[model samples]
Target: MHLYDGHFGGMHLIWWIIWVILLAWIFFIPADIPYQKTIKDSPLDILKKRYAKGEISKEDYEESKRILNSDN
Candidate 1:
């Protein structure tokens, strides 16, 4: 039984490569994770923006805000 003998083996090298790849995949490379994409605007927020930009009348903004906030 060769007790490691203070030498690098094939399995040891392969494991090092595997760990490096796994770590790089986990940290360096970017992937689509939750909350990583651009945030979406809620209907109410969009309605407010439109009203602020003069694209929507005040009545339309109020009605849309009510509809969005309604339980139904």
Candidate 2:
């Protein structure tokens, strides 16, 4: 057995203790968050709702609906 020198031995022991604590902390932490469901409305549905509410003209509504449906 080696006698404890003042320099390298104390530093090595301190580093090892720190490393173990860090590893334990990493292993025990929760990985997943709770899921929340949000209501997602499509653009055409929103346009139709606005049209029904008299927020947009019929021509404008049709134009916007056409634009929303056309992918290319």
Q: What lDDT does the true structure give each of the candidates?
A: 0.87, 0.86
Off by over 4 Å in 2: 1-35
Alpha carbon deviation, residue 24, candidate 2 (Å): 41
Clashes of each: 0, 0
lDDT by residue (tens digit), candidate 1, 1-56 = 67587565777889999999999999999887886767899777888999999998
Per-candidate TM-scores read 0.47, 0.48
lDDT per residue for candidate 2 within 1-72, as digits (tens), equals 556656567888899999999998889875655585657888888999999999999999999988988964
Best model number under TM-score: 2
Task: State the displacement of the C-alpha of residue 2, model 2, in Å, after optimal TM-score superposition.
Answer: 72
Clash pairs of candidate 1? none
The CA lDDT at 7 in model 2 is 52
Give the per-residue Cα lDDT of candidate 2 at 6: 62
Highest-lDDT candidate:
1
